[model samples]
Target: MAFVGREQELAELAEALQRAAEGEMGRVVLAGSAGIGISSLLDELESRLADVPGIIVARGHATEPRSALPYAVLAEALGDALASLTDEPFKAVVGSAAHDLAALLPAISPRLDALGIGREAPALEAAEQIGSRVAESLRGTLE
Candidate 1:
C-alpha cells in the first residue's frame, strides 16, 4: 500500500538516516499497539532507503519463546555481521574482544575461535558484571 499521512514521522526518520550516513549515531524507536502501522512504516522506511550506500538495515523479531533470552533480538540483528567477521580483516578489526561475545551469542563462538580469540573467565560473581561484559562485547562487535 502507498504510504499516507505520516509526514512528520517520515521527516524524523529521514533526518536520522542522514545523520547516520554522515557517520553520526542515530537511533529511532517505534512503539504502538498491534495493528497500528508500525510494520508498514518500517517497510516504507526500508523502501525509501534502498539505494543509500553503506547503509545496512538489519531487522530482528522477538518471538514469545525467545523474548526471555537476554539480548535475543540483538543477537538476531547482528547475526549476519558477526558471521562475516570470520575473515581475517574483520576479525582483526574485532580483535580478541569477539571472544567475549561467545558467552551471550553461541553462534559466534566458532568464528571467534577461528580468529584465535580466547574467551575471558566467566563473571559468576555478579549479574551486573555479566551485563557489562555483554554490553562491552556488543559495542566492540558494532565498532
Candidate 2:
C-alpha cells in the first residue's frame, strides 16, 4: 500500500509470482537508495497476489554501504526458499549446505557477515563457483 509510483516494479513482481506458482523459482533483485519504495512495491505485489498459489514471499533488508560481502542478500533469499521447501523430511537436502553456501558470493560477503555468516572459507572466486552450483541445484528442484 505504500507504493505510489512503482507500476513497473509491480508488474515484474507479479510476473515473478506467476512463474513461482508454475513450479519455477522466480527471483527479483531490487536495488536502490534508502527510502526508495522497494518494500512498498513488494507489499503491493503481495496484496495483489493474495490468491496466487505456490508462491512464497520472503524479505530481508540490507543496509546501504553494506553490499560488499558475498551472497548476503542471496543467502537471505535462499534461506527463505530452503525453509519453505523443507516441510518434508526428505527435503533437508535443500538446506544441507546453507552454512557453507553463505561463504560464496563476495559481492554480498560483508552483508552476509553482518547476518552472522562471518566465515572466511571458500574465498571469493571459489565462493562464486559454489553459489552457481547451488543455484543450479535449486533450479533443478523447482523444475
Provide backbone clash counts, one per model. Answer: 0, 8
| Cα-based lDDT at residue 113, candidate 2 | 45
- For model 2, the local distance difference test gives 0.57
Q: For candidate 1, what is the total of clashing residue pairs?
A: 0
Instruction: List candidate 2 segments past 4 Å from native.
Output: 1-3, 19-26, 64-69, 89-143
TM-score of each: 0.69, 0.56
Model 1 segments more than 4 A misplaced: 63-67, 80-94, 110-127
Task: For residues 26-129, write the lDDT of model 1, one tens digit per residue.
Answer: 46767667777777887888898778764555555654557568788777767755554437755665665665567667887776766677776654687778
Model 2, span 2-83: residue lDDT tens: 4567887777776876776687755677878888777777777768766866555667668744566555665566566545
- Sliding window of 10 residues with minimal summed lDDT for model 1: 54-63
Candidate 2: give its CA RMSD in angstroms. Answer: 7.4
